[model samples]
Target: MATPTRPGNYREQAKTYDLTRGASPTIVRAVAEHLGEPRGRTLLDIAGGTGNYAQVFATRGFRVTVVDAQLAMLEHSARKLGGGHAVAGAAAHLPFSDGSFDCATLVHAVHLLQDPSPALREAHRVLREGPLVAVDPTRENAPLFVHEYFGLHPPDDARPSAEDIALLLRRAGFATVEHHPFVYTDTADGSLHALHTNALHLAGPAYLRNTSFWYGLDEEARRAGLDALARDLRSGRLEERVRAHYLEAAVRGHETVFAAWP
Candidate 1:
């Protein structure tokens, strides 16, 4: 997914970013657990749109600062944080002094960076001997139904794998790097119908519009894919197809959290 270079690119999407792209509690728990006790330590959440993850960390007693390039996103983040720190800044050029934060998190936002190396180095610069935890969906995973339905296959050149992120951290002067692969399985009752319904819900318009995958597709492809999906949904074939897809791959996908010690 390409990162939007300007604030205007996210103006429209920022309004409903939280409604459609809320933080996954499971992922939030994993991030918190990895970071360990906050003990009133400060955390810098880079590219933290809407502060979804940052607010959760704040509740756990971490002094969280959410930084994003888009003012619109930071506006939502500011509201969610309730007078907490939310700054408009770029990842590579964070407006903070060295060793400012105790720990840092970059959840599902690394791919949005046009160039990740400088940002990773900057993260290393601002952190004071703490782990930088980054969470992202790796390329080495089962294809998501949303991607397949929308004809949104991420180009290998653009998508960074878990290994790539670890390598970047190491290059940025992190001493140790560990990868924890997380798979979010369906928790619904073990029924084909339920599974199909769950998959269908994920492919809905609200959810689709929020994903980077949907924006990656061309106008022609978007129209064609939507038409095909609509046809399937109307004809009752969507359930059957969704069931078959899940039967082939029971797990949702592989999202890895890379913890790098500075």
Candidate 2:
């Protein structure tokens, strides 16, 4: 049988996924603020991975519906956040009525797609003429320590750019698309061992599996990259600054907004 087309390696990572990833209050607030008031609005969080992003809007009285291909992730979201409609579906084929939502969000989930067009179209189709906000890290602003360990370049085309995101939105028939560039910088806490743990959360399939970054490398490269990260952490050669470059979209005027991508 052929391997199924999926977004991320959540099935294996579900047990420790939340521990690997973080709770970025700044990111959550920014995404929610861009969408304006949420008193009675409805949102579709596509591939929402545990509903961390959805909770921000949901707490403010927005009716949030989360959909992901991973049942483990949906169960996790339910366990943590407690009250959102959870669905099992692919982003390319959302099991939603046309114009069913006031707006939609994709919290760093877009780049995980094997093809972006179909998901973008589906997002556009589900919203009631509102914005479909997305967020993700730009190659330029990625943390140097992590990127260098992985042997990635400054202009790596592996990840989508803000411009590419806007073009994708435009291609999906969004009339007005705006890119908002933001920077999220932080550092690891605790000893070298803690740094190693934190780094593992961001990379490697067995750990976080949040992104396909580690999966893109060869076995040799992957092992070497991770080893180097550990060595640098232990020896105190690394600065430990996580300079995450982020792009947030404000689409379709003052109504809807793009959420995020990983």
Candidate 3:
């Protein structure tokens, strides 16, 4: 199997990954609730960068295991969450016994994966009996604010659409497959400097943490786009609502929170 590589992948962008994360308490809570019952169940957070979801699970009484390909991400997650509670591995081949976890989570990062299909298969092997919640970008289903400014569409590659994901889940032998749409909304209460900084952070780190399309862009293109965005922001051409959308999935109006499970 071939592992994909990008110039400024998670290994390099782990530092700033969570600095401007769009997740708020509301969003996290929604995800937690979507996870079904969290009590006394073990979880496998595949490609669980920086333990954001794992941290939430741990507090909710679910014994959590965060697996990622980058040691740096797990290490940073440890520091931020105050414990070394993650493993370094690929989703295609998780290092665990059969039926090891009660549930598995493949968040937004799956689209960037080298082999998402095999990863879903691995999740099936590891889960004892519970739902595997796979979240992908809800961009296609919603209007985007980021698109208006940067035209930041994810490049054509291995990223799967919602329909494709459902097919994959069924192909992977998941039972009772279901799709749930969640919306995460965050509002900033008059913080100009913070808003400006967040605007740049949304583009990428290097131009990113996840959502590799920004990283995939040429350096010149990313720089030019950021400059124009800054100009609009400072000139009042860009409003606070626009900045809020950038902070999330680049859809200024709404962020698509698509979750699939079985």
Ranking of all candidate structures by their lDDT, best first? 1, 2, 3
| Candidate 1, residue 26: how far the Cα is off, in Å | 1.5
TM-score winner, 1 or 3:
1
What's each prediction's clash count? 0, 14, 7
Per TM-score, what order, best first? 1, 3, 2
Which numbered prediction scores highest in TM-score against the true structure?
1
lDDT (10s digit) by residue, model 2, range 195-240: 2324434344344234445445677877877788667656645434
Candidate 3's C-alpha lDDT? 0.62
Residue ranges of candidate 2 with Cα displaced over 4 Å: 1-7, 81-84, 139-145, 150-155, 185-211, 216-222, 240-262
lDDT, candidate 3, residue 8?
A: 40
C-alpha RMSD by candidate, in order: 4.7, 6.4, 5.1
Candidate 3 positional error at 203, Å: 7.5
Instruction: Please state the error at residue 4 of candidate 1 in Å.
Output: 8.6
Best by lDDT: 1
lDDT for predicted candidate 2 compared with the true structure:
0.62
TM-score of each: 0.84, 0.77, 0.77
**Cα error, candidate 3, residue 220 (Å):** 1.2
RMSD of 3: 5.1
Model 3 spans > 4 angstroms off? 1-3, 6-8, 80-84, 143-159, 187-211, 240-262
